[model samples]
Target: MEILTGSHERAVTTMALDGRLDALEAGQLRGILSETIERGDVNIAIDLSAVDFVDSAGLAALVKGMKDARQAGGDVKLVAPKSADAMRVFELTRFDRVFEMASELSSLVEKW
Candidate 1:
């Protein structure tokens, strides 16, 4: 899995998540996101359009990222999920509300 990260603006950072996100890969993403958020980022947009799969661990990592960001006085938003499996997980977990779900990366970043 490749988690490509870059800043689109001073306040917004984008992570293009690709490949599978499960227990084995979740930790890598977790570390990357935590670092990015901790570095004074106010808005985050995760481009999951390249993600092929996501499991419970992946969901947990995302939740942790969101929680950490909000707790830091910021916010994290999820762009449209590419994998149907990931979509199902989000829907089943009712994360559609916990995280501001957006169909496009631009919309998510524009919110803040």
Candidate 2:
């Protein structure tokens, strides 16, 4: 998987993910989020539009990232999970309620 970074008007940063989010890639995702938070960028939006699949490890990474962000006085939101499988993972895990989701990056960035 490939993770790309972008910034918004506020201090919010976006991580656009491409490819599958599986066990191996999940660790990379965690590392990226941890590094971002360590740099004092707590408000993060994960753009999962390009992600076609996600497993339990991927979900755990997201959950951990969200927890760390919240503890840093910020949050992590999901943006445009267009894939049915990706959306299903969130829905089945009930992460849709835990993390704020938006149809677009602009909508999520506006929240910060």
Cα-based lDDT for every prediction:
0.83, 0.91
Per-candidate TM equals 0.91, 0.96
Instruction: Give each model's clash number.
Output: 0, 0
Model 2's TM-score against the true structure: 0.96
RMSD of each: 1.3, 0.9
Q: Which stretches of candidate 2 lie over 4 Å from their true place?
A: none
lDDT of 1 by residue, 1-112 (tens): 8888878764788888888888999999899888887778757788887777788999999999998988888777888686787688788888877888788888777776
lDDT of 1: 0.83
